[model samples]
Structures are given as C-alpha cells and as structure tokens.
Target: MDLQDQLKNLFPDHEPEESTDKIDAKPSYWLQDDPIICKYEKRKGKPITILEGYNGADSDLKKLAKDLKTFLGVGGSVKKETIIIQGDFRDKIMAFLKDNGFTVKRVGG
Candidate 1:
C-alpha cells in the first residue's frame, strides 16, 4: 500500500487541515514617502551614479544597492545608507526604482 493509503488506514477519522498561511507574491521593502535622489557625479575622473535620501532600514538599502548593481551589471557599494553605482545610470536606475514602487528624484545632469 502507498503511504497515503497506510495513513488513511491508521487514522480513518482524521481530516487534513488546510494551510492558512498566505504567501506574498512579491517581496516588498519599506518604501519611504520622500523620493530617492538619483544623481550623477565624477569622482576621480570616473563617472558614477549616486542614490541617496532613503529613509528605511540599512539592510533594505543595501539589498537595493545589490539589486541595482546586478541589474546594471556594474560594481557598486553602500556607504552610510547611500548607494554608489559605478557608472552614470541615473535614468535607468530611476526607472527601475519606480517600477519597484519607490519614488525617484533625478538630480543634476
């Protein structure tokens, strides 16, 4: 006999309980009211994109930084809650953040 048949034979009156836990379809992070600032700058003669003004947990910010780096296929880091991307990708970054339910404010050219 199969396992299910054995179990049914052992517990004839027992009924399986339905699962009540709800799983979120997508992962969500703390979204702040203030828009995240996306700016461009040249540091040591290399163009870089900086995203700042995030008023959320540092871990979330770091996760965001890691996601951005992977999405853009570039190197970056998070320092003091600010995300520093290795290239000038303000427009793309802003669009990605907006799509992920974060307000983005583009600053400087």
Candidate 2:
C-alpha cells in the first residue's frame, strides 16, 4: 500500500502539526504518518530529499526542515506540509528523530 494509505490504516486520528522553520537546538520529536523522502529532481542533481505527510502544517514542517538541515549540514525547505532537504539523509533522519524521542520506521528507503 502507499504511504498515505498505510498511515491512515495505522492512525485514523492523525493530525497535521505545525513547523515554524526556526533554528532550534532541540527539535521536536513526532511519531507521525508516512513521510516522503526522495531525492530532489531539479538543481543540477543536487542530493535533495523531500519529506511530505498526510498531515502537518507549514510552520511545524518548516521547523523540521530547519532542524534536519542543521543536523545534516545540508539545504532544505518546507512548503504545503512538505519538508525538502538536500541530501539522502534517511538513516540520519530516522536516527535523529529517534534520538530526540520521536518514534520512526523506514517506510521504503
């Protein structure tokens, strides 16, 4: 099943949180639905990863982008509930979230 479908089946009451894109030394941890992390297609093959969800808002998502970028020392952004980071940071991403108290699982790779 697709990420969204799996997430819906996993948590029916899942809600969209908010991200402000601020640079916080301590990022928030979230056990959210499926997050879409794919290499960005544009920018001359820059290793960009895009993370999207069924829920989550611009502010919270922006926060995610900022935190991940700083953590991985890469570039990224957040828009329309999507957080895009420039790099294949799947392993680091999952570990970072978990280390900060967020439950996570690798959906695909």
Candidate 3:
C-alpha cells in the first residue's frame, strides 16, 4: 500500500485539515499610487534605462528588477531604490510594468 493507504489504516476517522500554507505562499508586493519613473540616459557614452520612485520593500524591487531583466533579455542591477538596465528599452519596460499593474511615467528621451 502507498503512504496514503498506510495513513488511512493508522487513522481511519482522521479528517485532513485544509492547508493555509499554499495561500500564504502566494507572492505579494506593495502597490504604490505614484507612478514609477522610467528614464533614459547615457552613462559613460552607453545608453541605460533607469527606473526609480518605487515605495515598496527592497526585496520586491529587486524581484521586479530580476523579472524585468529576464523578460527583456538584458542586464541590470538594483542599487538601493533604483533599477539600472543596460539598454534603451524605456517603452518596452513601461509597457511591461503597466501590464503588471504599475503606473509608469516616462521621463527624458
């Protein structure tokens, strides 16, 4: 018999309790009302995209940065409260953030 069968034999009248761990495991992040700024700039003659104004946990911001970099197939880093992406992908990043329920404000060309 399997583990379930053994368990049933050991306690035939036992009723399993609903697990709340699954519900708690769901990822959640703070949603800010103010728009997140997406700015484009040239650093050391290389184009870069900067994202700032996130008023959430640093871990959440880091996760966001990772997701963005992975989705865009680009390199990036999270410094304190800012995300620096190694490209001029302002439009794409903005759309992605908007889709993820973030208000994005485009800054600088």
Candidate 1 lDDT by residue in tens digits, 1-109: 9998999999999998999999985457888899999999999999999999998988888888888898899999998879999988988999899888999989986
Q: After superposition, how far is residue 105 of candidate 2 from its true place, in Å?
A: 3.6
Clashing residue pairs, backbone N/CA/C < 3 A, model 2: 16-56, 18-60, 19-59, 19-60, 19-61, 20-59, 21-62, 21-63, 47-87
By lDDT, the better pick of 1 and 2 is 1
Q: Candidate 1, overall lDDT? A: 0.90
lDDT of 1 at 57: 88
**Per-model TM against the reference:** 0.75, 0.54, 0.74
Q: Which of 2 and 3 is ahead in lDDT?
A: 3
Where model 3 places Cα greater than 4 Å from the true spot, the runs are 1-28
- The clash numbers for all candidates, in the given order, read 0, 9, 0
- Evaluate all candidate structures by whole-model CA lDDT and list the values in order: 0.90, 0.65, 0.90
